[model samples]
Target chain A: MAYPLPVANVRLKNLTKQFDGVTAVDGVDLDVADREFMILLGPSGCGKSTLLRMIAGLEDPTEGEVYIGETMVNDVLPKDRDVAMVFQSYALYPHKTVQANIEFPLKVRKVDKVERAKSALAAAESLGLGEYMSRKPGALSGGQRQRVALARAIVRKPAVFCMDEPLSNLDAKLRGETRAELIALHQRLESTFIYVTHDQVEAMTMGNRIAVMSRGKIEQVGTPQDVYDRPASVFIAQFVGTPPMNILPAGSIETGKHLVGVRPEHVHISPEGSLAMTVTLVEQLGHELLVTGRVGERRVVVRQPAHSVVPEIGAEVRIVADAADLHRFDPVTELRIDI
Target chain B: MAIDQIRGGRKIGRYVLLVVMAAIVLFPIYVMVIGALKPGNKVLVNPLLPSNVTFSTITRAWRSGHLARALVNSSIVALVVTTAQVITSVMAAYAFVFLKFPGRTVVFVLFLATLLVPLEATLTVNRRTMQSLGWLNSYKGLTVPFLATAFGIFMIRQVFLTIPKEMREAASMDGLGHIGFLREVAVPLSRPTIGALALFAFLTSWNQYLWPVLITTNSDYNTVQTGIAALQRASLSQPNLVIAGTVIIALPIFVVLISFQRQLVRGLTAGAVKG
Candidate 1:
């Protein structure tokens, strides 16, 4: 079975959603190119899920226009929008078998039974769920249930796929494996994928571009490396990394009226460095060490290779980053300063 | 060794208590069955015993009481009322739980307020309305007043609230309208509660005595309860006949309760434990 490539792009212009007086998604503008895998990444309460729901037509926007390809769909129903969504809960029918769950969308469209079964079987086999077709979701493992949800979403071959943290329920090992499978699926399906999650690793790995959101607004939209190397704002720099960027007072580094930002990997202990701090904790992460220290009133962490000499707790150490590796941000606006 | 002996004593004591309770509850039923089997003359002689066993009394009561037709009529009324109650309750519960309308809470409160009004208070008005509609001695009058119950709505609504909102949204995304979702998803997921409700409605409708006696005057429309009453009045000297009639009427209720016992327990305890 050959999958048809989608030619539709999703464009959101000044989309806003308010619940009773609290604005959930406020004045957000974004465009997902045809066949592009775009991830909406944010912390909890940041409106990433709400924005995804609005795009899926499960939610009505209080204001703004949503365009799929060339048609604006503000008043369009969810089914008529030609978009499928995979929920965080999976939302598979508990009473239905895996085969029936996959066939439900097709069944609702009045597709004949034979064609429905054929399509459902193909989708199930594609997801390695062929042997589990007769099982209900309650009997399946979390990863299998998540796969069943994916198969259901793909069975219809909608133009745009909206995923709301679909892999959050899986264990760590299975999450990694399924994350790779999802990337492969995006490539094979060749459809626009708009995924929402707070896990920066997922956004960095699977998305062609990540839209970093904060407090109901888009902070930055860029590639994984772009957001990492050159975060547009203080929030992006702190949010996009594992230990997060080390934000320090300007006087701690070079003389400037702005704050300094440095990645954990770039901060190192050196005898000749300028900034001095007391090492409070050291965590050995098998292949690396996370050294946390306190400078004045702020805490900073430095990631060092396991082979490096281990620092002693309560020992005073000087940390430094090369001038070229430093990022500057305005203390007032919190926006990045290029110079 | 000491602990084992104490545990054994406690277990034996528990079984003894359970047996005593069981005997107490079943004593009346045992007497009824024994009296139903004995002839009218021997009913007062050793009423606790099962001697002089015979089916003649039950057979005689069946013929003289017109109970076969009464059983058929009661079955029809109960089945119709049960089916209608289940459907009406599910639809009303769905509206209460899923639909957005103005004054929804107020309307639900009003529906609940109907439950507070005792059935006796509405009996006079209901009979008058039935009379005006010329439905006396008909199945319509026997079943229409109970087709939709506020208690049914409230019980079903509690079960329906357990269905996550995501299921409805998922159904919507699958292109299912309200009716389609209700039929394919809502109704099926709520089977246990509906089953329990159906059994309850059937038993309630079957056991009705006052309303059926008041509204029904024709012997053709005699229900099991009314038929049993008439049998008691006609055979005052032969009290065993009425006992036989009661034993027969209880057979269907027993079968229904046995078959639906699992659903009743599960549905009654649905939300007590959260997954």
Candidate 2:
């Protein structure tokens, strides 16, 4: 990176936040390395956003401490925390021109006019918003407004960037485009990026590591492949993959006291397999066919190539998965177990 | 074809109804202008028709009513009141909307409760306070009592609530303090409502009749409203003179309303739709 940004790692220790009597973010501890793009991934109401807000200093934690680099910043104001945030709503100043919105941070810090204009122009141009500099946020499209928000966050070149589902408002196609742009921006700035999202695809594609959360708790933190392949718990195993992992009762496949877990892609139909299922439905998703069926009383989905022969509804079929692809979780604890 | 004819007939009926309503509203202004143009003796005769037109009546009324001075006095008071009310209202509304404090809702309710108390109810007490402070018959007396209104605060706050909470958070993250955010974001975003408030404040202060009559004894301190009363009292024989005085005094308000018509509509209709 050519720019000199004050890159710093973020560390949270025993952080907790409660709204009224309900706990939104429970005691949690995590560390993000310098310039690492860490993602907080979860379902809605899972407290990933609350956790991100605590780190950004927008929301105060009820307990514990937040560390930026080596300094404890629990008492510091958001302005002094050296972190910029891109909100889900974009939150660009509606009255300010795109150029002025980008320059707002510098303007508040009393930067000189010439330097502010230069930096604003450079930021806008980098975001491909050079022509819309004079336009208000109301005049720009949703994706362009999101980019302007990104430009505003980057203009000051803070140590850490906090994005709370910044691309959620954009259409799917635009979201994909901005996802790539954000990755490149993170690389170019060489700054710590902590992103919060409920989309698993975004977590897998954009994050260097994903912290999966549920019920105000971090279930597991690992790389996308690690979390997908060797999830620490059944919750993470189901949450990190499309169509989720199928969980069958104990002893459904082999004699065991644990539940069996297998990914939809790993489940296959075979003529000589052991488990028998009745086909219920099939969804053709262009390149893949999602075959849903009932194995005993549990519904299971299997991913097959689009070219495969479609099974008739209510027809019996044998299903099988390799032992290596199977995951075992204790039925009572819901935690993974090794043979 | 029958339906089209019926629709056309209904449209013409609506136009006719609108014309009648407009005429009813404009009749008084028409009478006033016609009355002002005629000599005092001819005013009562053929009041609806303009005849023996004389511009001298307006000039005479201006001189005898001390209208030039009155207009200046009214302008100063209205402008000062408008500016002060806008500042106070915006600051108060921002605090009520954004700042966290104890008893915030109770305090805001108490503030709004003042709106139910009519100005006439507090007139005597306010007059005594102004007199004790020696603001009577002065610009201070005219403008100070109405510098801030609860209605203005409530109106502006309604508009302010429409601003997303994320905007304030974003501003804070960008290093803007409360004042910075209010000045740079909140105020500019609420400009239409503020403009409407300013117009309302100016008109209210400009047309103040009872307050100005109660506080001021000196003709030198007379506002346009009080000056018009004085003109009527002095020119009992020349009724047109008083009418001309009113016509002159109303010009500024008409101009203000016409110029701010767009803002007024937008501001009034604000909060009617959820953004």
Query: Against the hidden reference, what TM-scores do the models get?
Result: 0.97, 0.96
The candidate scoring highest on DockQ is 2
What is the TM-score of each candidate's chain B when compared with the real chain B? Answer: 0.96, 0.96
Pairs clashing within candidate 1: none
Model 1 has an lDDT value of 0.94
Residue-by-residue lDDT tens digits, candidate 1, B2-71: 9999999999999999999999999998999999999889989999989999999899999999999999
Alpha-carbon runs more than 4 Å astray in model 2: B1-14
Candidate 2 chain B — worst ten consecutive residues by lDDT sum?
Answer: B266-275
Model 1 CA RMSD to the hidden true structure, in angstroms: 1.7
Clashes of 2: 0
* Alpha-carbon RMSD to native, per candidate: 1.7, 1.8
lDDT of 2 by residue, A130-164 (tens): 99999999999999999999999999989999999
Q: lDDT tens digits, residues A1-339, model 1?
A: 448855589999999999999999999999999999999999999999999999999899999999999999999999999999999999999999999999999999999999999999998888899999999999999999999999999999899999999999998999999999999999889999999999999999999999999999999999999999999999999999999999998788889889999999999999988999899999999999999999898889999999888889999999989999999999999999998
By summed lDDT, which 10 consecutive residues of candidate 1 chain A come out lowest? A1-10
All DockQ scores: 0.86, 0.90
